[model samples]
Target: MAVYSYSKLETFKSCPLRYKFTYIDRIKRPGEGIEAFMGKRIHEVLEKLYADLQYKKQNSLNELLADYESRWKANWHDNVNIKKEGLTQDNYFEMGRECIRAYYERYQPFNQAITLGLERKVVFFLDPEKRFQMVGYIDRLDQRPDGTYEIHDYKSSNTCPEQTDLDADEQLALYQIALKQAFTDAKDVELVWHYLVFDKEFRSKRTPEQLEDIKRTTIETIMQIEAAKEFEPSESSLCDWCDYPDLCPRRKHFYIIESLPMNEYANETGYTLVNKLAELEDKKKALVKEIDGEIVKIKEALIAYAKAEGVDVIRGATKKAKVKIEEVEKYPYAGTPERKELEALLASAGCLEDVMKASLDLGKLAKAVKSNIWSPELIAHVKKFAVRETECSVTLSKLSERDLILDEEMSY
Candidate 1:
């Protein structure tokens, strides 16, 4: 029954655990990324510009920049995180200022289109029964002289997506749906994204058919969310920007101990254990070559001794080394042309399934299960014969200075 936004849908897609923590549990976390802060500051400036234009008061570039600066300083706090190395708050502030400047210089006098609304709140149903509802705020709504309505979204991010991506974007497109529903003359609606950092504008329009399709897909997504029982965490590079790392099962330990002082961190139990294991592994690898060479020589000598003595077993004080000879068939190595042809022959003979059943690769089966490559029914059928087990592995990598300094300001 909760009113959903584009961000909510996106959060669910990105990380279901995060979605649960945010919208379901309503957990409040202090601090936010500096990138978001800069975007907000830029959005506020643009909102003010459109709002003032409606009141017949046009603000100059300097006035707008001053306003932006004031807002930034007022809202700036110590907890605002800057994740990128070699970037300071001043860099972001200047970037935001430049964004405002670029926008102002490009669209001075503000007359290309009539400003209809600023930070316009839009709520609309994705279904006829009004069951799945979506809400979003348009950065600026404009109606041009030709009666073409434009839903404008402001982006302060440095990277501008390709046109193809914008064409498929759903946020402004959803707002367009709302615009059409609200205004009768909104037939010719355009979705516009102002990439302020790049001083660029991208435009796309959703066809009636596309709108209907999106609604259907969105409703399906909502249904999936509603029916979800286990909201598993999806970890990716984006996890670095996630706010609930401390609550995430995969990241909790790292979150808890990452801020410890070097002395304490070095002595930490898990760290020391992993370090010792890695050290032992390195020593093992270094000795493996020499040991392997000696083992090969001894094995050859043992074989000769066993053949000369006509004995299959050679005994020491308390142990016996058995030399047993057997012939084994070897097929063409996997991925080779011969192997492929052999596979094709077997498949043509209708023996592929039986062969697969005879020597099934559990790794491949597990991968298929994790990737959901099979239907639910097929997965359940296969899962009946499989017992889930946890496999722990340790990989060694030299820690960077940045890793040691992760969340240096994190207290709790």
Candidate 2:
């Protein structure tokens, strides 16, 4: 079995079926988006830049871009989505020029770079007959004074935050682990994510725990992939953002698994209460879902009706409408003194049940209205939106309420 690289592990995690296409089948996807092209181009530039730095060769922006432009053209994959025929010579040059400009502006000012760049595609055949193929590259290795190695990869496109968006990235983690094999003397290795876009750089660091987790997860995933009968697509919100959604079969497999007959639900307790609670919980969730879906449908229809008739139900404080900005407002309704006096008089006369029932009616109206995602049009006609904020209820008297503020404040 071959030792998997950080790239393969990342490919599998991104979308298993897509991963299978590129890595397993070795299909070259066409570059359509600037993001895809720029990332690869940036990688090439960084690899060359750092390689030069390692050997103490000072490289200028023009030279770096020239090298990167050449690499981009040579390594450009024939993506089906790419209208490569339409790309004029001028267009390609302009694209390359813009890419290099962005890169230079981002990195040139930095007097000290932790690591200039890295290259990881260097192939080393271990076996005498070259049967066992092992290919790896240490693009740029930054040896810190503390004797720890900071493994870094360069990227282009829009710069993304490392700590905020890439704190849990497994690619960085796997790279950390892989670097150990390349450098035997380094006792500790640190993973760093560096993104450069339009001359701005964003950096992030990875922990030892995360690096170990990547190693374990990648090994397990690789084993599973090798043993599996098929590589199924993961159908998630991520599917919409994926490039290979049309080719994946994860959704079809879901329907297959859902249709198959299954045994009854089991429990470790083996108690009747467990079964009872399970049944009730499932039923409650289904009912809630149905109610929520229907309510959303109706609300959308109502919004459509209002729009077609050219009537604005929601009156903004100003002349022009707020135009769907997320607004958080505090509303206070003044209590009538006469009404409270009358209610207190009624309570004194032992007619409190009637008043209490009226209050409950208000509650029922709120519950009836509150169900799903709150739309502005739905809140236009009424101030009472059923507020079933998440609450932990042990007993009727022992309740802890947690407000789920979706911004639109309504009582009921």
Candidate 3:
């Protein structure tokens, strides 16, 4: 049985290759950002506060701040990197302290509900078959005097989520199932989040139907992860903070060049060459357009002369030009009399399928066959009556000026 968590499911959705690297391959990287370090320390302080409350002992604000500072100093290490620019390690450390102090002030005396568990681990089966298990830890679980359960989570980030975002939260929704199972009398479970940095609290509830929908969606996501053969990397702004950049095939080159000297990296192989090629390609397209306009004007003059002389073909030094007119049939509307007549005739002749099949884009049909959306038998049937046409295209080449001049002389 595969175990799922909110982070695990979110990781796969954000980038399947990252999930594969973290969960499947079990690649380990050392060190973490200062933000995560601060969050952990704050979570410890909050957990301690609740644990003391469970014992009928209230921790004063000064006592809590003292414990927070002590832990912050004790766990501070060299590997914790600061991600924001122009900020030192002390800035984040103090920021976390301020968040804890604000939280303590807002919810002082800490006796809102009866404490059930601190940093409680909850696990529940998402399906009746019990093939998929969801596991997560609630920051604080409490029961009110009225027997309503509350699942609390703490956030140390500077930004607070919107109300709609909290309403759609999956972690607490999954926890609701565990709460219902653990406490048979549990009713009207509420999801609560403390945005510590902002000293704000958000609450929402999930209906039974919503929880069912979440279960179905989670199971479907897990099945996708199980069936996925190619876990392609998804590049985004978050790649900068990814721990496996050196191991990732898509990002390894970037990390390697980032370590190189600026001048050397700038002149690295194909770096400037590709840029110059792009510039030259743009110039070539502009020149082609100009030359095509001149060619059209010359061709028009030749055709006018040929028509005056009652000639179909005009011979040049090394090539010949001919003027011809073609007649084409148009069916602009489906409700038109001509189109209706054609449709009736085709239906009576039992060739409507052939006409419909012929109207399909051959390239898209071939792609559908390749992707197994359409079977080979269908492709073979279509091939029996399909007509193949070849088209030739010409484009300006990225050659030296001297070589282009020499080629032009040879053409004449």
Best by lDDT: 1
Error of 2 at 406 (Å): 57
Position 360, candidate 3: lDDT: 31
Q: Tens digits of per-residue lDDT for model 3 on 92-201?
A: 87888899899988888777889899889988888888898989899999988888899999999877899999998898998998888778888879999999888899
- Predictions in order: lDDT: 0.83, 0.54, 0.80
Angstrom error of the Cα, residue 95, model 2: value is 5.8
Ranking by lDDT: 1, 3, 2
Off by over 4 Å in 1: 292-412
Alpha carbon lDDT at 115, candidate 2: 61
TM-scores of the candidates in the order shown: 0.72, 0.48, 0.69
* RMSD for each of the candidates: 16.6, 20.3, 12.1
TM-score order of candidates, top first: 1, 3, 2
Write model 1 residue lDDT over 81-136, tens digit each, in one string.
99999999999999999999999999999899998998889999987788988899
lDDT, residue 142, model 2: 77
For model 2, state the Cα shift of residue 249 in Å: 6.3
lDDT string for model 2 (48-158, tens) is 666676677768888887887787678666561333457654465565567666666665643354563456544433234543333455556676666767666555534
lDDT score of residue 120 within candidate 3: 91
After superposition of all CA atoms, the RMSD between model 3 and the true structure is: 12.1
